[model samples]
Target chain A: MQERTVKITNRLGLHARAAARLVRQAGQFKSAVELKREDTGQTADGKSILGVLLLAAAQGSRITIRTEGPDEERAAAALLQIVEEKFGEEAPDGLF
Target chain B: MDSSNTSHSRNSKLKGLAASPGIAIGRVLRLDERGRRQFYYMEVSAQQARTEIKRLREAFAEAHARLKEIRSNLKGELGGQHEYILDAHLLMLEDKHLIAEAEREIRSRRINAEWAVRNVADRLAGAYRHIKDPYLRERSADIEDIATRLLTTLSGHTRFNMSTLDQDVVIVAETIWPSTVGELDLNHVLGFATDTGGLTSHSAIIARAVGLPAVVGLHEITKNAGTGDAIIIDGAAGEVVLRPTKPIIRTYIEKRDLDRERRVEASVRSSEPATTLDGVRITLRANVELPAEIESLALFGAEGIGLYRSEFLLLNRLPELPDEDEQYQVYRKLAEATGEHGASIRVFDLGGDKLSLDGFEEEKNPALGLRAIRLSLKAQEIFRTQVKAILRANSHGKLRIVLALISTLDELRDAKRIIEEVKRELAESGAVHDPELPLGVMIEVPAAALMADMFAREADFLSIGTNDLIQYLLAVDRANENVAHLYQPLHPAVLRTISHLVRVAEKAKAPLELCGEMAGSPIQAIALVGLGVRTLSLAPASIPLVRNAIRSIDQSRVRALLAEAVKLATTGEVEALLGRQLPRQAPQFFAALSSLG
Candidate 1:
């Protein structure tokens, strides 16, 4: 298993579009990817947009990404990179 | 289960809003989710459970395919701006939690596939309901949307096969989503009668675009009618009759044929200018709520978009308004669509009965409370953002800014000050914009109407919103059933106020327009022209009939009729006079109007 913790830096955190992007990235790896919100202790499947949205991971919140299977390491890295990059969203001042 | 075969002794009639005009008589096709829920919980044996699980899987797959097709089709139509919405729906369909949970419920709870899916969706929706953020909470609607699609698929309601339907049928549903309207085959579907909807809903707009007769807000059409039950819908009268007797059906059939013949005659002359027989020219424009409705303007021979209600863009994204870029894109589209003819974009008219944003205090009477320009002035940032967008979009084509509900001169001046400030900022930033863009005031409040001469002097143009003006002038809420009868457009007081506005605008040499339900009605439209108003903005579906009415009248004669009308004491007196006199002057137009009854 591969696990890493990342902070949600985007202004509108884990919104529908952001969650969709996360799910799309998670689906690329042949691994079971899960996201656990550190503050609330809530867990959701990273590949499920609804589950990710239900996590309610707002901005400045910490979440741990876990991936297991043959491609676990790559999946964990990809999801962590997505979160660290704010899911390719522009800066806070930019229009959503 | 055989509800269609049930004896039809009780012939019921329902009254609703006239969403789209015309008539339709056919058997009903009940797409009622509530009715389907009754059979959702039926249990099954292990052997049947296997089949049910397979059925569930197939439904998910089929729904996924249909959504994919819809997404691709809409890509070209909407310029892929709303692609993310459909993308999320497709993702929800294939979500592991949704699919696996349904399968698990089917096996362990021994419930039918429909019940299992519904159960899981309800639980998730409940969770979403508890969300603290209003924007995120709104996402729950997306879940419900997908679940409805799955349920429809599992119940063998094949919305995808509507194009191949073997018989002409009237669609009876609790609510018809706009996306579903895109999938409907107009050739097979005669009309739409929904238990819930309004005249301005997206579905109703599509129905009008395709010339389908629709009566919405029937409240219980689905409960009263079933698949294959005889149904008759009179859209103009806002009447829906279920298990319609032969006489009722015959009356509607004749009315329907007359409506069709009249529509064909009107369309043939739609390209001609709306000039009175006496040679006075009148410009007819469309009141648009959505960008999708832009396509219907040219088809209806609308000169331009008169009232682009920008507030609709705020409805879906409330709590968080659409950013400047998003608003700019929509306004640019409107400007381009209208082109040289020009378009008027009304800034956010939030509050009132239309919408109450999150964190707004509950008012005792919202209609009279802080709304329109009042709300916009209070939330200057929201107002500035929309103004900035409109100004930026003005570079694309001819566009005017219209401020709504400017009851006081100070409010109009304040809004104009904000627009000027925004224009300065845009110019400083070196953004492309039209510095000469016109600013208009919507004369809706009784105070504004009484002070029309002052507003006409200050504002570049004046557009009378008769709906709210009459409601306020008479102290009658049109939406309230008790006092709705008193919400008269042709009341003597309303006519006098309008005539006052006309004289004031003419004296000021300011362009004047009227955009309200009264302008859409043939009788009231003639009265408007008679009152000296030269431009009218109405629904796209109403343009043909109103144009035909305008072409049929002699303006000088109607002006004389108006002189007699304002002297009348009551609404009934004025209505009787117009009803008696208008027919004589415009026999063909009155003939079409009488046939509607």
Candidate 2:
């Protein structure tokens, strides 16, 4: 299993729209990804947007991710890529 | 000049209205070749006339089918009424009497089929002009609609409604129909100047809905605007300028762009939450009426939908109930749209501004009548259907259910009992639904806010419906234009109620939020955050400004201010303190929103 604790840098933290984008990216990998808030220890399916949002991880909160599969390294890397990039700096076009 | 001083009758000009609003310096495309627009029925045997009628019927059927398909695809965007309008057209055109009359006229007059169709079209169109209901009367276009269809079928050509004229055009008409609005190419169109319609009328509604600039109720505009005449349409001020000077045009153009840019920025910034300078967070959500409104969440940056106002399904129709599945579809869309943050759906808050009950005869007062939680108590079945739908949609995303206008603990208890009843019903029916549904109440009336401590202990959460809370606490009917000035959201009494409720909620460690107009207003939002209100629900458009205000404040100082403001004796004293402290931190938002008071 690959695991890492990352600070939620995006102003919104891991809210709904961000979770959706993260889950979409996570699903691209063959690895099974799971997220857990550092403080609450609430576990969520990294690929299910609903499970991620229900956690309500606020801005500045820290969360940990766990991955297991042949592509675990790639999944963790890509998921971190989105968090680090701040989901492309702007919300998706036509979001409203 | 008066009939050579003998007849004493002044000459008058017949007014054939240009119906669509616009002033254009283009060649008159007067639709004058009425006969040429249609194909004539050839002089043939009775048998051929019958066959020709059959062919026309078939053509009409095909056209109706196509129109229905177009209407169905557009149902979500244009709403159900548009489809009904098309259906009305099909029924009127296919009326047996009307169709047979035209065929009879064709055979008897021994004239072309074009003349016969025109005669029938004119009669039907004229009948609609006198109908009492304005919406129905406007259906006269259905006759013109049929004529256009027949003309297209007969002439093997389609007439384009939009003209690419070289000169500037300001549309002047009695009323601009939606279809005409849809057909026009706005590139060459300057603006719409209409003779009739108030702010909420169809033309005004459509113009606002479609981002068009329009000024209505300009009487005699048809006579005022001439071909090749220059005109300026000022929709904001409801004025039309004829032969405007170059400087005036330049000034208007600048104002138009500035207004457009501000609106664009507001929309763009709407999608974020309010965070204080010290990083204190406040939830900002949108108020929506339809499922499609969910699409705006990202644009508005709302945390979730604060007020769902689910009464839409029950209002404006027969008092029939909507089943769980139908309600689930709407709730699910909202829940899903909030992405992961989820939405708070206030169960059908009917009665205040809306009336759907059958037995509630005319009352001397409606604001204090049986409404909101009271109505739900009366209509158990209607209430259960809403609860069931909400519970079912819980599987889709984060969903919280709140009951509005709750006044007593007993009301909350009674609502809980009904929710239990719905749970039992859902289980007995083996329906798929979330078993654990967290329910809350709106702390609006003074009694509710005063006793919120007890109710917060009973319910999972509480949402302060500020609009009602302010009105009820101050004994002000906000809708009454006469006393609307007294609708004070920042009143110390209202703030104290909020402060008390938040304290109680904090003691119980219960979730609490505010879903009211006050939650969106700049000064009120700052005061709310000062009172420790972390979650706020507002209109989508207000999200950015509210967020900007929150981001500019120091949370600890705000708390201190709230502590001081609450101790004040009167609402006026509290208002004075807030006026001094808040604007210093958020001068722009405070200045813009203070005028709203």
Candidate 3:
């Protein structure tokens, strides 16, 4: 199992497109992926768009991703990379 | 449905209308979805549970297949953002929790897949109801859409069968959606003759783009015709002949060939100025709602947007109506799209059978109740935000913001006062706006039409909304089927009202245009022209047809017809005069729209 605590850094928060990007990248791996928001304590299936939407992960909100399976490390790393990259939008001003 | 079976008009003709003009004769394909819903809930046994679960699995596969087909079809056709939205829906179909819940419903409750899918979808959507963020909650509609597909598929819906088309077909439905119109086999579709939609309906726009002969706003068309029945559609004439005899088919085929040539001629001549034979130029502006229609405006030779209905901005934006910034973004895009001609943007005319704004409760009689400027005045804050947005957007390009549904003199004054106050506040806040920008009133209700001089005196311009004016004058709701026949624009009262308003506008020297479905109709437009209405605003699809009607018409002939008709005793007599005399006077204008060989 691999775990990483990453804050949502996108300017528009984890909106429709941003959530879609996270879900799509997460679905590429074989690992069981889940995202838990720190404030709400609501866990969402990282590979599920609806689940990710339910997280209501706004900008500056911290979330932890836990992945376990054959592609655990890659899955965790890819999700963190997507969040850090701000889903290809400019970094939310204070995030860096 | 039964009445449609009995009432086949003379020559087997069914008069609907041509929203998008062309000609076609093909096998009728009845694509009706309304009567396919399940009503009864049957009890399921423990042994039957396994089969129910299989049915649920089948539904899942079908949903995914349908989504995959739609996604693949729309792949290159949509923007990256729209494509992402579809991908998110695709991901949702594979969501373990959603599927698992459906499985749980079947196993434990022993309900049918359709009911179980709907039940699960309702529960999921209910979760979204309390959320403060409108955007997040609006995503709930996506879930409902998927669930509808699941339920329909489980109920053995055969609506999505465009994958194989061996023969050319004409689609007949109550209403065909614009988005789904692309999914239909466009290459083989001879034309679509639907039972609903006006010239400006979303489906009509798609029909024009795809070059299909589309006749919308027919009555009980789906109930009248069946699959494999021969259909002859005169799209320009808005005529349909269902189950025609062999002789009739031969005649229609000959007519269809003639229509094809005429359509080509019309397309080439669409760019010419709409002027009468005596050299009176008519300003034909397009009534547009969506920004997508902006491109079509230039193609169809629209002078400018006569009515840019801003209510579309109020659709599905939650927690509140769209703020000033959001509205400014869309209005700015509209400004750029309009180029030199600019647009007449109506303020958000909410609260009338429209989606509730900021959780406004649904009214019993939405149309007559507090709506348009009435609602805007009460909801001053939202109205001010919208006013400021429209004013701010004028800096990008010229735009005239019009207030809707102004019945009395006071309502017009109240609106003007608020607009001026907003302008002053913007100036104080150091935001730029066109203080000299034109603001107009939509002369819809009878009171405004009667007091046309008063409204003309107060506002810079006026656009006659004959759709609402006729409906209000006749005390008939046009949408209500029971009263629809009574909603006549050719009524003696309606003509008198129009003539009175025209006379008033002329005396005041107030520049006004009739922007309504009535003006879009060649028959009604000729009458309006007779009443001295030079500037006519209509749907983009109707511009060429109306232009053709106007160009060949000598102003004196139509004036004579109007003079004779106005003195007629009844609506029927007036209509009789219109039906008889106008065709004789302007033979070429009627001939332009005719497909009859």
Candidate 4:
């Protein structure tokens, strides 16, 4: 199992578009992935749009990326990267 | 006007169609047409949830079809962007989170699919609303949309799915279709009131035939009705009182108690033969459809199943018809269920208006076209399969196969010949079957009634299907609301035809049974009994009322009325004669008939 915590730096937080992007990224890996809010401890399936949106991880809020199974390392790395990239949204600095 | 009286006092009386006749006061089981279900799913059992899962899947399929239709309409007229949204909507129909989550809750939490769907949607909606992003919050509307569609489909199925009732209660609905009424729980559903339909509608006919008290055409009753509001339905008076005052409720209770006492009194006669006052014995039988109805016959203490429609095997059985073995199983089940009492299995009466078989072309006027025995004869292989299967089943139990729609002597002869051929084939093959299987004809057409004597001379017995007889005799389609009034059972021509059939069948000493909606009515039963037609087969639910009607009858007086009934000029005169004579001769029967309305 692999886990990582990262702050949501997207301008609009973990909104529908960002959640969709995250779900698409997580669905690519052959592993069971989940997301949990650091503040509320809310859990959601990483591969589900509705589930990810339910985490309500706003901008600047830290969320934990947890993955398990044979591809947990790659799955956790990809999900963590999407959060760090601000889910393709334009950040305040406009830097990747 | 003879129906069960509740209390003399009444308030807020609402008139509707007198669909079914009975007196019932119960907590309302209202279905919210708006799909705003207020109930929770936590108490639903696993079995219920299992059904709910199936319902959810059905809702999905329904949504797919609806979305596809919308897309088809939006084709070319709308741009690609709208089509993309529709495609997404269709995809959401199969959303694992939306459907699978609801299924999980149904199994794990033991809640209904509707409630679970709403629950999951609510939680996700709450999260979506909490999200600071406007885009994510807007997605909540999509979840609400999907939830609404699923709930609508679930509610739609239950509105007509009468088998889901866990307890006896009055059904309060905005409107009910004839087909929906056909699917209701005949045994448990005490009565119903709808926002539409009149006395001659199919719902009313079925309700009256099944002996359920109903009041229809009560517009907006569903809006005011709740899940368990106390309701009083006066089917006889065509009135319904919702949330009645205490005094009115007390009066209804007294009325219901008295009716219950009378029912208890009637229980003793359930085991007795359906003999009238003059020692004229009658055979009270049931019209069997689905094989499961055999239990209902036994429950109602029916002497036998008179009209077991074998066509039910072919109708709606697309892709593949039941082979000889499947047909044999159903035939055997009915025969065994009937016990010592005989089972009459009508040959497949497919084609025409009933149902179209493979390769059978739809006719311009199906009722007058090739149907029943005509279609069976044309499709000899199909007819032979049914005959051979019936013969095979009779070897196990007391089963008699009757040929339906024998319009002419030639058709009867041909049908008889086929039966002989099947018998020979069975003999040559040394197959186990009833060798001496007696064949009969269903006397529905005018030609059959006219030749009742000739047919009875050779045929084993005759069952008069008055439903078809009256319709054909008057040249009126009883199902057509426009001509429904002309589809009178008391038409002078019909009474003469029935009187002739009874006299002929009696002189020949061949068995006879009147199996139709006509025989279900206490008033009509009196007239038929008076006409010297001793055997009556009708809906199983109507057995008690018909039996009570038969017991109350003085055969001698009815026989006298019959003599005058035949001399009557019009259908109105015949009705007037029976209406005046029945209540006077058999007040108890008339009172019971009042309750039947």
Candidate 5:
């Protein structure tokens, strides 16, 4: 398993659209992707939008992304990159 | 099952908001969702669990297909602008956690698929409700929406099959979503009575658009009603009678027939002008929100579209405002549809309780805060785009611009200046538009009504939006049950304020129209015409009744009645005077009104 912790960079945090993008991205890999909120200890399936939303990860919150099985390395790297890039949203997250 | 012979059978009435105008008596079809937090729960055997799982899978597949179809259809119409929201819904449907969690509950808890699904959805929604962010909290509604769809599918009442219902029935539910109303087959459905919704809710709007008799906000109609119970819905009176006695049913049938006959008579005479006996011509127009409602204008004999609320367009495409081109197309369609009579497109009245835009902070008093004209002025970019679109569509038909909630002279002047700026830009761009397009001000705010003389002089036309005016003038919130009784239309203050507006508009020689709930009622229409108002705009269904009322009354007598009514000290006195005097003057209109009750 490959795991990496990252902070929510988008101002709106893990909102519907942002969570949707993450889930769609997670679905592309042949790995079981899961997310765990650091402070709340809440865990969610990265492939489920509802589960990801259940984390309610607000801005500046830290979450750990864990991926297992065949494409774990790529899945973890891709998710980490997306989180760092703020889900390709504009700076300050104006596209509400 | 002959309940009529049983003395124990309960006969009860439910009071709710009069969402649509008409009468319907039929057997009840209680659509799923017995209550907001309650569902049909049952246990299943080990072998039956497998069958339940298969049923759930099929339901998911059906819901997935329906969502995709709706997405593609919306994409075709809106150029894929709103696909992101639908895409999110699609992803939720495909969520492994949602599906697997429900399946696991059905197996472990030995409950039915519907119960399992509801259990999982409630948990998820409960979590979402606790979310501190308002935007994230609203996501719970989406989950509930999906669960309702699944439940409906599991109930074997898929929207597609609603049309195949063998018998006509009145739909009783906790709350019917607006989208579901569109999918219902009107042929088999007589009307709707729900536990929740107000007069201006989207479901109510759809019910009006389709001409279905609906009574909402009943609180517990679904609990009192069972599938196939004898039901009667008086949409005009906002009453729902369940398991009605035979005699009550017969009386309602008579009332229904008489109402239908009167409507037919009104419709037949609808083509004639609404001229008073003394030769004053009254122009009757429609207050519409959707394009679908425009088709009923001719049927109801509305001469033109008076108040076309443009906020509906915004409501459909929320969080993201429709761009100039998108708004232009809708405005253009409205202009062309209204034809020579023209349409007055009011700028979007956002804020308040209507809709909360992304950037707007939660206000303690939204009704008195940045709403209507204030929001438009503050959000100049959105205001400018809408004004530019209205101007661009002016070339198609006789279109007028109406601004809502202009409480100050500066607000009116600023809105006019912005409109002028947009017009100038369009002119410079060589866009074909009506250069002489008229601009009107909605006299809804108390301050606006007080400054009617100045507004009438500056505005090309004036419209009295009595709904807000009455609410503000009386300091009564119509939505608050405690104070709603004080929100009277015939209140002495309301009449005097309207009388002042009419006199000022006449002095300025500006065309004035009253477009509000007051104008829709036959009794109030009489009072308004008596007060020197000549043009009235109301819902299309109300036009026939108001026209018949207008045709039946002699203006001279009503004017004399108004003279006495304005001197009354209270709403009760004014109402009593009109109730006693109007029937004598317009017996035909009174007879029709009596038939409805």
Candidate 6:
């Protein structure tokens, strides 16, 4: 399993729609993924929208991701890529 | 009275049924009484008293069966109060004492069967008039309807024949029921005007449902519309036109055609999202009262239902609790209607402007009184039933539960606990529903918005119920017409509160949506978008206008306008800036604002 922990820098925490977007991205990979929040200690199947919703990752919180599958390395990198992209920066227009 | 003394002496042409059991001066025209007779009528021979009783029993059975069918369909569509009307109909249909007394009178007095039926109806109607319940009082119509049908059957006039009604006649009546309104062919009918029934009454519901041009609650419409006289029914403005000039007629026809064309265009654009010039996509959902209203959801291009006021299930003298299965059927039907994007059912927000429970006396100040989640918390059984119903409907499509009037963390926690408990019960029972239903709260109260971050901690999402938020924040009563003008969501303080709440939810990473009357106003709705609110729930009628506004606005320009408006000192100042800037940058937004009044 490939694992890494990163502190959330986005001002808004990981919301349901954002989490859904993350889940949508994660589903693209042939990898089993899990996201565990440092604050709530809530772990979610990175592939499930409901699981991701339960994570409720807030700003300044640390989230650990574990990937295990054929494209584990790419999955972890892409998942990290979204976090680095700041959840599609500036609310992606009209999503209130 | 002499012919000249008669009220409708001027227009002697209109004709319609006596709907409200009173003499009304109305223009003569083909009127529909089909729906009134559909639920009643005795077909058995009057010679055999036993067979007549048997036929009455069968009629009662049919009424009971029909009530069950319409009850389930109309429960969530109209308010639960409507079903009581059906209940009264069923009670009168199976009135053993009334039937027995009428049977005795028929044998003893040797009265005609039709007169016997009419006599029973009159006594029952008189009894209904004595009843205190406004709902039961309306049931007097059901009695008259059934009696009319039975009398018609005996006379062999099975239908309320309108063969004498001529074309080009504007019919006027004291009141109209759905059945009577349904009989008039719109193709030949000029217009309809009535003195009774409120906006959501059966008459109005049918008028809007059938797309007829009707002006209701006009006190003397029937007296004014003279026969063979040029008359116009201003369905749009709720006005009546009499002896209108050729120019005026031409103008009305032009306006009517334009309105029809606009409605057609709106229906066409209903399925599309509100996307901006700069490619920003906004989810525009609809706030609906009935499932029938959902027909326009697709026509308005609603992303989904934002606020499904579930309190319609709790109103009236509901003898038993609304079961989980019953609630599930309603929610499932709504969810299915919205299709894949689904609906968000705001759990019953009862009290204040809503029906008061029989036991709970009126509060001194209902605005601050028990309402929404607060009332639900006090009445745990009612709350639990609603939670279970919503949970059971989750599997049909995307479903979310939104708790209203949440002002504190403890309330949120308690609500969350109740929802969790219901989920557990469903699990234990092996109820077939989506276990992971997303739960949220409407941030309507100022306290809720002020402490939105705390709510975001436990809740799955947040939708701003700005209608109450404005009323509560401004200390203004929305229903009171005096300070209704003061209820402005565009006020800097209100905007700041929304901004703060959105920022807090963003900080917590909780998805947020704004579903309010303000979200439909182009000026206020665009401002919310600039303040970082992306999802807007609006009335279906405003969808195309709002969608058109969003499409015309450039995000960068809107962003700049927001930055300027926020630094402003007052609501007036912000309005001034928007007035100057919006017209220049977004002409469509300015156009929508102009059309507001």
What is the C-alpha lDDT profile of model 1 across B401-443, one tens digit per residue? 8999888999988988888899899999999888778999999
Model 4 Cα shift for residue B295 (angstroms): 3.6
Q: What is the DockQ of candidate 6?
A: 0.00
Candidate 2's displacement at residue B402, Å, is 1.2
Candidate 4 segments exceeding 4 Å error: A1-96, B1-19, B27-169, B172-190, B194-230, B235-238, B242-247, B290-292, B296-301, B311-320, B351-364, B481-483, B506-509, B587-597
- Between candidates 3 and 6, the one scoring higher on TM-score is 3
lDDT of model 6, residue B164 = 31
How high is the TM-score of chain A in model 6? 0.87
Q: List the residue pairs that clash in candidate 5.
A: none
Q: TM-scores of the first chain across all predictions?
A: 0.95, 0.88, 0.91, 0.91, 0.95, 0.87
lDDT of 2 by residue, B1-597 (tens): 011122211221122212122122211111113422313223334654565555556556666676768767877887642444554454544445566777786576543344456667777667657654454455566567777776555444322224424454556555565435444565656566665554433455445333456666665555455434456565545566665666766766676666666656766765454678788878787766545456766876878888886775554343666777888998888778876777888877766645446766755677788888888888877888788888888878878888888888998999998889888988999987876777888888888888888988999999888877887888876544345557677677777788888889999998998887676556778889999999998766557767878887899998999899878887788888888888886677666544322
**Which is the winner by lDDT between candidate 1 and candidate 2?**
1
Q: What is the lDDT of residue B225 in candidate 3?
A: 76
Report interface Cα RMSD per prediction: 1.1, 22.6, 3.3, 4.6, 1.4, 23.7
Compared with the true structure, the alpha-carbon lDDT of candidate 6 equals 0.66
True contacts kept of each: 0.59, 0.00, 0.59, 0.26, 0.67, 0.00
Can you give the lDDT of residue A85 in candidate 3? 91
Per-prediction TM-score, chain B alone? 0.74, 0.61, 0.70, 0.71, 0.78, 0.64
Instruction: Residues B22-111, candidate 6: write the lDDT tens digits.
Output: 011123331222323322111223454454444444444555566567667787776643454454444444445556766765555444
lDDT (tens digit, per residue) of candidate 4 on B1-597: 001122333356777655565578876665433332322222356677788788778888898788789889999887753454455456567556767777887788665666666767777777678766676678788778777877766666753234555667777765544334444565767778766554544456556545567887677566556545678988767789987889998988787677666655665568877788888888889986655567777667798888887766653355478999999888888878887887888887765545567777768888888888998889899889999999998977788878877789999899889989999999999999987677888999998888799999989889898887887888887545445557788787888888998889889999888888788767788788888887888878778778888888889999999889989899899988888888998886777656534
Candidate 2's C-alpha runs over 4 A off are: A1-96, B1-253, B266-273, B567-577, B587-597
Model 4 per-residue lDDT at B339: 76
Q: Identify the candidate with maximal TM-score.
A: 5
